[model samples]
Target chain A: MPHDHDHPHSLLPPDPALRVKALETILTEKGLVDPAALDEIIDTYQNRIGPRNGARVVARMWCDPGFREEMLKDPMPRLREMGLYGRQGEHMVFVENTRDVHNVVVCTLCSCYPWPLLGIPPGWYKSDAYRARVVREPRKVLAEFGVDLPGETRVRVWDSTAEIRYLVVPQRPEGTDGMDEPDLAALVTRDSMVGTGLVPGPTP
Target chain B: MSRVHDMGGRFGDGTVAPGEDAVFAAPWHGRALALTLAAGALGHWTIDASRHARESLSPRDYARFSYYEKWLAALADMLVARGIVTEDELQAGHAAEQSSLSERALMAGSVAGVLKSGSVYDRAGPAPALVVGARVRTRRPARNTMVEGGHTRLPGYAAGATGTVVRLHGTHVFPDSNAHGLGEAPEPLYAVAFEARELWGAAAEGDEVIVDLWQSYLEPA
Candidate 1:
C-alpha cells in the first residue's frame, strides 16, 4: 500500500483555536460543559484578576512573624483562613532568605509553579534553556539574569518533582520599617518569589 | 524509542538560547498532526470490523448494523492513505508488547530512570557524591564557561549562594557508555537554605531562603 506520506504538515501546530473549538463541541455534545458558561469563565480569569490577592496574604504574613511561621509550617489552613486558596495551588512552602544563602526553583520535568500566589510564570522561565541549565549551572545562569553573587556564597537549587511547591519569602529589604501591609505588598515581585530576581528597591 | 527525559554527560552542548522572535513564532501545527494521526488510526480499525461483518453475517444483519457505522469507514480510508496499519492487520500487533504487564512496567521504569538522568539513555541507578547538608563548594569547570561539565548541582541563579543541609533525596543517575547502560553512584541530595540578602543584596526580604539541592551542586560553605 502506498502511504500518503504528506506527513500532515507538523505534529504540533501553533493554532490552538481550532482545537479549542473542536474540544468545546465534543464537550457540549457529551454534556460536560454548557456552551454559555464557557465565555464567562474565560473572561473572568483572563482579564480582571491579578496575583495581588495572593500577594496580600503573603504581605500580611510578612507583617506578622507568628502568622508567617504558621503559614510556612502549614499554608493550606492559612490560605483557607484568608480565603485565597483555589485553582492550581493547594499547598505552599515559603522559603525565607537570610544573610548566608539564596533559593531558586525549577520544575525539571515541566513548569510546575505556585500559581495561587504568583499567577502565571513569565515566558523566560518556561523556556527549554532555563529549565535545562538552571539546575546544572545556577550561578552562571543567575548572573546572566543580572543576579550576581560572590564566589564564596553557596547556591542551592530546588528541582520541584513532587506536589510540594515553593515560594521565596525574600528577607524584607531595609528602609521600609513603617510601610503598611498594602505598600509592602507592592515591594514583592514575582521574580523574588521564584528566587530569580530579587525584590526591586522600594520605589525611589 | 528514546525516553524524553534522559539528558546528561553525553559531551555536547544542547543549550540554545532562542531569541524572543523565534520563541513566539507559530508552531502549533504539531498538535493538529497528533489529532489527525489519532483520527486516521480509528478509521482503519472500523473499516476492518465492518468488512468482517460483511463476510460472516447475513445481508439483512449487515444492513441493520451499517447505519451505526459512521466515521469508521472514513477513518479506515484515512488510515489506509496514511499507511498506519494495513487493512488486513487492523489490530494484530496492538497487544503484542503491552499484553505482559510486568514487562511493560519494567520497560517503563527503566525508561523513566533514563529520562531523568538527562544524559545518554541507559538504565543505571544513581549518582554518588557528598551529603545534602554536607558543606561542599562547587568545582569551577575546567573549560567552556557556557557549558556545565563538572560534578556540581549549583544552579545558575543560586551559584555562590550557600545554605545548610535540609533533606537527602537520593543518589544521582546518568547514562554510562562504560557500563554499556545506565550508571549510578551513592550521592546525597540536599535542600540548602540561603538568605534573601545573599541572593538579592539590598533588595532582599526576610531572613533566609531554603533550596533543595543535590550533592553534586554544593561545596563546603
Candidate 2:
C-alpha cells in the first residue's frame, strides 16, 4: 500500500454517478456498508412503503370513525400497528382538512417528508419552488396543484421542521358512503395526503 | 449552514413538473441513500449532522451538484471528518484489501426492524419557554444575512420573523445544535403561526404558514 500522494486534493470523481459508485465501493470494502442491507433498504422505500400506505390510513380514517378517532388521538401507535412505522416517520401528527380549514406541508430549511407513509418525496416537494413559496403563497401554490379551496376555507401551510411529520387528512368527498376500504383507498391520492391535491372524485 | 438549502420565500423558482414520482432517479441515488443510512446506523453522527454536511457545501458546489452528488459529497465529508474513513482511501476508491472490520454492520434481515424502530429524537427536556398563543420572534445572527453559517434548523426566512404560537408540540431534538456533534439538547417544539404578510410582506396574502420551531428559536415578541 505505497500511497505516496502527499497532497490531499479532492480525488472525488467529477461525475455524480461514478462518485456515488466510488463511495459505495469504499464503504463496502471497509466493512462500513452491506450491499444486501442497502438493497433491502432501497427496496422497502421504492416499492413497499409510500403514499399508498398513507392512502390506506386515510381511507380507513374516512370510513371508520373509531379508527379515525384513535388516529387523531395519536397516529404513531396506530401506524405502527398497521406496520407503517419507519424512518423519517418515527413521530406522527395528523392535520385534518375541513370545510373551514385546509392544510399543506413544507420544510423551508430542507426537504423532510414522512418517508414510511409517503415513500420517497416527490421531486417537487424537494424543489426550491415548493419550499420557498408555499409558505408565503399557500393559496397560489395549492391552486397550482389544482387544489382550489373555497374563499372561506382557511389554508394552513405546515413546515415539517422538527421530529413531527404531518399527514394531511383531507375531507372525504360527499356521496358514496357505501364504498369499501379498498375502493376508498383507490380514491386517495398521494397529493391528497400531502394536501396539494384532492382525492379523485367518485368516478364521474 | 449555507442558506443555499433554505429556499423559503425566494421568488420565481419555476413550476413543479407533474408526473409519477420515482423514488430514485438512478441506481446510484439509491446507493447514495443506502450508504448514508447505513453509516447513520453506526451512530457516528446525528441525522441533523448529516443534513448539515449535505447542506454545507460551498455555494458553487451546492448550486451545481445534482441531488445525489450532494449526498455523495456529504457522505464522503462526514466519513473523513469523523475519521470513519480516510480521504486517501476515498480518493483511491480502493482500500488496502483488508479482510474485514468488526464494525456493526446492518444485516439484510434486520432492515424491517431497524426502520420500524427508527431513530427517536423526541426526548423529555426543559419546560417550554413560550406557551400556546404567545407571540414570539425567531432570533437572527448578529449581522444580517439571508443565510447562516452553522448547523442550524432556523431557516433564514423565519429568522427575526414574528409569529404566534398556535400549538404546543412536545419536546424534540434541536437540529441546530445537534449538527455539530452538539448534544441533542431537546427542547419544546411549537407550531408557530405566521401570516403570509408577516413572512413575505405584501407580496403574500390570504394564507398562513405554521412552522415547528424549537423552544430556543423563540422569544416573546
Candidate 3:
C-alpha cells in the first residue's frame, strides 16, 4: 500500500478513536489478533504493572543498605528475583537521587519507558512538548511540574534508548529511619521515582 | 535525511505539563496497542523495521496521527509489505480468500511468560574499541544498498557534540543495520554523558544529559 496518493489521506477518519476501533475490528475478524490476548494486555498495562513495583524495590533498598549495594552492582539478577521484569525494562539501571544531584528520564526519540516499573507512561511523557523542551530547559520544564530546586542542586536527564531503560530512585525521606519497608514504600511517589518530584514528608 | 522523530535538546516547542494516568484516552488506543504487539509477536518484521515504517511517513503525516494511530498505520504497512495481508483484504477488513499463512496466537494465560521473556537484541560482535571514561563524539555510520534516509537511534542533537563513556553496555543488535535485516551485527553500546554546556550554550551550564549510544555512533573526540 503506497501511502501517498492511492491512499486518500482525506478519506481517513478524523476521529482517531473510530479509526482504531475499525482497524481493531478488521484485524480481529481476520483472526490475526486474539481478542483474549488483547484484553489481557490492556489489563496488564492498565493494572498489573505500575510504579508500585518500583516503589517496593526502592523501599527495600532504602531499608536495607546491603540490598541497595547488590541492586546497584547488578540489578538484573536481583530485579528478576524481585519479580520486576517486563518489556521495555530488559536492562534496568537505577539512578539515585541525592541531595546535590537529581535524575530525570525521557525518551526523546519515541518515549522509551520502563513499563514494568512505572506501568504505562503518562500522556505528557510522550508528548511533543515534553520531549522537545525537557532536554533544553530541564529546570524550567521541571518547575512546571511543581519541582523547584536550589540553584546549587544539579539535574541529570537520561535519554533512554532501546537497549536500556532508567528508573530514578528518589532520596529517602528524613526521619524515616524508624519506618518499616512498607511505610517507607508509602512515601515513594511515581513522580519522585522519576525524579520530577520530592519524596513526601514523613506522616505525623 | 534527518527523521523528525529525532528530537533532543530541541527548543521552543512550548510548555511541558503533567498528563492523566489513563492508559488510553479512548478504547481504540488500547486495542491499537494490543493489536500491534500481538501481530508483532508473529516475527515477520524486527522491532526496528517496524519503527522505521512509522518514522518513514511524511513528517506531516507522522505528526498528524495520534500515538496509537501511528501504531496502527505501521502495523498495516508491515502486514501488507510482508505479503501476509493484501491491501484489498486490509481495506475490506477481511481476507479476500483463505490465507495459507498461519499466525501464532498468544493466550491470555501466557501473556506474563511472553512479555517476561522479551526478545533479546544482543548478538555476537567484535571487542569494544573504547572503555569507560574515554571521550568520544557521535558519527554518521557508513551505509549501503538502501535509501540513504531512514530511522536511527542516534539523536541528531548530540551527533557532532562530544561526551565521555560513563558505562559500557557490551554488544547489542545495532538498530540502524537491523532495520533492514542487515545481519545481527552487534556492537558495544555506551552510556555517553554530555555536560549541558557542551550540548547547549552558556545558558545551560552546570547541567548534564546522558544518552545510550551505539559503538558505531562514536569516534574519539
Candidate 4:
C-alpha cells in the first residue's frame, strides 16, 4: 500500500476512510489496540444498546405511577435497578417534559450524550449547527424538526457540561390506556426522549 | 480566549437540518470511533486530555472535519504527543517500533467489562460549598479568556452570569485541571439555571439555560 507520505511533499490521505484504515493498522501493529476489541465496541453500540432501552423505561413510567414519581425525583437508582447504566451514563438525570414546560438537551463544547441509553448521538445532535443554534434559538430549531409548541410553554435547555447525563421523559401521549408495556414502548420515539419531538397520539 | 468548539449561542453557523439516523453513516466512522475508544482505554491519557486535543485543532480543520474525523485526528495527535507513535510512523501507515505499553491492552474479552464499568469521576471531597436554591454568579475567565493552556467546562456565554442553583451534584473531577497534567481536583457541581433573558438580553426568547458548573466557577451573588 502506498503511504500518505510516499511523496516528498508529505501529504496525508485525502479520504477519511483511508486515514481511519491507516490508524487501525498502526495501532494494531504497535500492540496498543486489538482489532477484535474494536469490532466488539462497534457491534455493542450499533446493535445491542440504543433508544429501545430508553423506550422501555419510558413505557414503564407511563404505566406505574410510583416509578414515574421516583424517576423524576431521582433517576440513577431507578435506572441502575433496571441495569441501564454504563459509560456516558454514569450520572443520570431525568427531565420530564410537561404541557407547561419542555426540556431539551445539548452539549455545546462537545457531543456529550447518553450513549448507553440512546446509543451514539445522531448526526444532527453532534453537528455544529445544532450545538450553536439550539442554545440560542431552541424554539426555532425545534420548529425545524417539526415540533411547534404553544407560546406559553417555556423551554428549558440543558447544556450537559459535566458527567451527569440527562434523559428527557416526554409526556405520555393521550389515549394510551390499556396498552401493555411493549405496546406503549413502541410509540416512544428517540426524538421525544431527546426532547426535540413529542410522543404522538395513538392511531384511531 | 474561547475556541471554535465552544459554540454555544453564537450565530450564523447554519440551519438545523436532520440527516441520516444510522449510528455510523459509513463503515469508517464506526472504525474511527472504535479505534479512539479502544486506544483511550489503554490508560494512556485522561478523557479530558483527549477532549482538549480535539478542541485544540486549528479553526479551519475544526470546521472541516466531521465528528469522527475529529476523533481520529485527535487520537493520532495524542499517540504522537505521548511518544507512543512517531509522526513519521503515522505518515507511513506503520509502526517503527514495538511499544512496551501493551500491558494494559484492552483485549477483546475485556472490552465488554471495560465499557460496562466505565471510568467513575466521582471522588471523595469536602462538602459542597453551595446548596440548592442558592443565588450565585459565575466567575468570568481571566481577561475574558478561558484558562490559559488549560481546558474548562464553563462556556463563555455563561461567564459572569447570575443564576440560581437548581440542583446539587456532588464532587466530581474538574476538567480545567484534569485536562492538563494536574491531578483530579474534585469540586462541588451545581446545575445553575439562567434565564434566557439573562444570558441573551433582548435577543433571548422565553426560555432558560441550565449549565452544570463546578464550585470554583461560582461566587456568592
Q: Which residue pairs in candidate 4 collide?
A: none
Expressed as tens digits, the lDDT of each residue in A1-204 for candidate 2 is 322232121467777778777877877887877889999999988888888899899999998899999888788878888888888998888999888888898887777899988988887787777887787777788878887788878888888878789999988987768898888888898988889998766885
Candidate 2 global TM-score: 0.92
Best of the two (1, 4) by TM-score: 4
Each candidate structure's count of clashing pairs: 84, 2, 0, 0
Candidate 3, position A155, lDDT:
85
Candidate 4: misplaced stretches above 4 Å? A1-12, B142-147, B203-206
Docking category of candidate 4: medium
Sorted by lDDT, highest first, which candidate order results? 4, 2, 3, 1
Model 3: clashing residue pairs? none
Worst 10 residues of 1 chain A by lDDT: A6-15
Error of 3 at B10 (Å): 2.4
Q: Which run of 10 residues does model 4 chain B get worst, by summed lDDT?
A: B141-150
The DockQ of each candidate is 0.07, 0.59, 0.59, 0.59
Candidate 3 lDDT (Cα, whole model)? 0.78
Clashing residue pairs, backbone N/CA/C < 3 A, model 2 = A50-A119, A132-B8
